[model samples]
Target: MKKTSKKNNNFKIPGTELNSSDAERGKKESQSNFVELLPLEVTSKIFSQLDIQSLCRASRTCTSWNHAIRNNDSLWKSHCLTIRAVCQREIDDDVKSGYTWRVILLRNYQKSKVKYEWLSGRYSNIRSPVSLPEKAMCPMDADTWGEILDAELEREVEKLQ
Candidate 1:
């Protein structure tokens, strides 16, 4: 007696054996957006951990991801709060004026960074505009200029003493 090995053909075309409704359902299931699979809180938690640039990139990847990121204010709030460390007055003013956290962030994010650099005296020694670092400088409000001036004055006073 000769023994023969049986081969299993596991590769099957999708919807081959299902009815029309079942095939449609299967297609929907297979094409379901991953962002929609998770609960809102779960997706928010996952997205909140991403850095600002990564979050923006993720939001642009697809409509579902943009919806998830855009609709959740908490993610933008947390990031805006971090920027508040450098731009407290601006952030507070915007918040008081009823600007959403995302809008506040969009308005202040780069300004805060530039303001921090100025406040931190990163540009204190520039002899002229030509000597300044090659970077994008956002327009700062008068109050921010005052703060930077104050920091510079304090440094000068310390030097004089």
Candidate 2:
């Protein structure tokens, strides 16, 4: 009886084998190139040019990028300020909480989006505040609610005419 080694049965691809030293060298060569090559200031400047969404995507690409993006509070602060232009009250409340710039933006991003929708009259026939998502209701006060309702009413009236 002949015993066949399980290792010998494994399939090997042609020309794909690398010795341990060669594999290590390949790993070194293929190591993430961007952050390693660019100066920190240059990398930060490049990241700063990205919009919020692009910055977020870039941050997820690697650990170095994540560190760069998260550590740079000014990047998040700038985005929060831009958002503030459209949703001042929400941003103000977030800023007052004394969270980091990243947290401030995270906390208010959705609220700002919802508030913009309300202000822009994106939803019609909002007979009650319950029609809105719970997160949307919290940042808004009675006056903002009234404004949304008034805008919705105006939209409905315009449709009738």
Candidate 3:
């Protein structure tokens, strides 16, 4: 087997933290208290500016950040209500058109004689009184939909960050 070459030291990728000096800075950035630097007002603005998806994404970055975001029920509730509003449109349309149309429009969501479900979490079945779409979108049980939303929201927020 060919042995690894060391241009400087530490055997790290060349030009990328190959030496102790570079590694120290890399560690410093991760350790930096960037979160603490932002004041509460600024943080609240940033938080408010963030839609539900952004807040969820921020929660996945690390333990401290996740806990902070999760604790903010207002943010989560806002997200839930927003999703509910969007999906409620479908239900309203379904009602005007008829139950038969509900089946066709929500074909992605299969239905049994018992009930209807959306196989696609991105889409939702409108439940009357209009519950949150977090449950509606899943083609499967809400257990799966919850996971899907959690993952999707985190991804969206990370991309923005």
Question: Using TM-score as the measure, which candidate wins?
Answer: 1
Better of 2 and 3 by lDDT: 2
- Which regions of candidate 2 fall more than 4 Å away from where they truly are? 1-31, 128-161
Q: For candidate 1, what is the lDDT?
A: 0.84
Error of 1 at 118 (Å): 1.5
Question: What local lDDT does model 1 show for residue 54?
Answer: 95
- What lDDT score is found at residue 93 in candidate 3? 48
| Model 1: per-residue Cα lDDT over 19-105, one tens digit each | 555555556657887687778988899999999999999999999999899888898999999999999999999999999999999
Pitting candidate 1 against candidate 2, the one with the higher TM-score is 1
Which 10-residue window of candidate 3 scores lowest in summed lDDT?
108-117
User: TM-score for all predictions?
Assistant: 0.78, 0.62, 0.34
Worst 10 residues of 1 by lDDT: 2-11
Ranked candidates (TM-score, high to low)? 1, 2, 3
Off by over 4 Å in 3: 1-31, 86-161
lDDT computed for candidate 3: 0.48
Q: Please give the distance, in angstroms, between residue 108's alpha carbon in candidate 2 and its true position after superposition.
A: 0.6
**lDDT-best of 1 and 3:** 1
- Which is the better candidate, 2 or 3, if ranked by TM-score? 2
